[model samples]
Target: MSGRDLLQTQLERGIAALGTSLPGGAVARLLDYQELLHRWNSAYNLTAVRDPAEMVTRHLLDSLAIIPFVEGATLADLGTGPGLPGIPLSIAAPEREVTMVDSNGKKVRFLREAIRSLKLTHAHAVQSRVEGVEGSFDCITARAFASLADMLGWGGHLLARNGVWLAMKGRHPAEELDGVPPGFRVEGIHLLNVPGLDAERHLVVIRREG
Candidate 1:
């Protein structure tokens, strides 16, 4: 099989493994985004992961794993270096308004191009630090961006009153639990089962304390 076919098969299997059904044409769009990412990474060094199959696992599947936890109509992916979860999630669920925020100009440029080329009407890219980003969102996602404390300290204000904060961590961040800042509490830490990914993946869910 050709490389693109292999990648498509891997992605389809991974989605099936996750037991999540994406809308028609979503998978194709996701692959298109991945291809764009691969092309840009060569010159811009956007991400550390380079292998196509690994990208399907670590980037695409890893991002889709959190689809079950994502809620609300608006989502802000802070520190979205290359729109990992945001872009994928936007493709899967075209109804949500996704804002991919990042400080890197090159990454943001790529994001814009992907949005236009993929016809992602609900997704947009913003070049700014997480703290500098304005407006509240129904859901906020931070993946490998910063420590729990620092991430919340800088961008906590962006979460709406009833919004949830989904912090994607590598492992169970037991030590950082205490440093989650006041007013917010850890609701749950879900173990993400990313297909073809053996490493530890945890999703720390936080919300305003009632």
Candidate 2:
């Protein structure tokens, strides 16, 4: 099957799974997010997963699994390569503001285009290093962005008071968390079951306490 066809089938199945496993209304927005990603990915190298079915596992479902833990507040996706959790999360929660930041101009361009095409009024894209972007957010997300220490050094300032940092990791990140900077505490570690993908995923929630 063509990439588009495979993607559609996977989306249908994934959405069904989400509807059964998660809350309603989330699946439909995920579908819309997939469509937006596919359209922009054709022109920009936003994601390495060219096949739609792969995207369902790598992008859509993977992103949706984190929705339950995210507090309903403004979020900043640091080093938002290809808008992983940011784009999908924004689609799922249109009422919440999501700012996606990437150092690469091309990726930021694609993210901006996707937001405009989807008419995501709550989504914004910024092309700058995490440290350069000035603002506080209720939540800061990072997917394969960097080591925990690096993220804390650069993206820590962007987190609002009482905010949390959600970091997606593969395998147990015991070593990564061991060296976390001061003022941040590990709140919780959640094992995520990403549909259609056979991989160990963990969402580490870090909070700032001053």
Candidate 3:
């Protein structure tokens, strides 16, 4: 089978394995997103995962694994290198506002192009340090951005009072808890079962302490 077809097959199986359903045209859009990433990655070295099929599991599925926990209507993806969960989540939930922030110039350009090509009216990209981003969000996501404490130090102000911070980590971060800021606390730690991925994935759900 061709690359696109193979990616489609893997995407389908991965989504099902996550027990998630796609919105209308989500599969196509995601495939397009993956293809775009692949194309740019050739020259930009955007991601380490070079194969399209692996991108299905490592990128798309890994991003979607947190969809069930997404809350509210506004989201900010800090340090969104190539717009992982940000773009996919924006596509999946068309009504929500999704802003992707990255400090890198080339990645920001790629993100803007992807948003334009995808016609993601609800999504926008900002080229700035995570701490410098303006505005608040009902939900925030930081994927491999930094340790829980350090991320909050920089981007914590962007989370609305009642908002939740979903920090994607590769493993259970037991030691990282000690460094968590005084105002925020770990609400829950969810083990993410990304399809076709054997590595440990955890979503550290954090909230402001009352």
Best by TM-score: 1
Model 1 — TM-score against the truth?
0.98
lDDT of 1 by residue, 1-210 (tens): 999999999999999999999999999999999999999999999999999899999999999999999999999999888997899999989989999999999999999999999999999999998878999899999996789999999999999987899999998899899998888989999999999998999999999654
Give the per-residue lDDT digits (tens) of candidate 2, residues 1-210. 965566667766775676535435555556666777777788876787877667789888888788777884799998888788898888778889999999999888888877887777999999998889988899989996788999999889888878899999988798888878999999998998777789999999999887
lDDT of 3 by residue, 115-160 (tens): 9999999999999998789998999999977888899999999999
lDDT of 2: 0.82
Clashing pairs in 3: none
For candidate 2, what is the TM-score?
A: 0.88
lDDT of each: 0.93, 0.82, 0.91
Off by over 4 Å in 1: none
Model 3, stretches more than 4 Å misplaced?
none
Candidate 1 worst ten-residue window by lDDT = 201-210
| Candidate 2: clashing pairs of residues | none
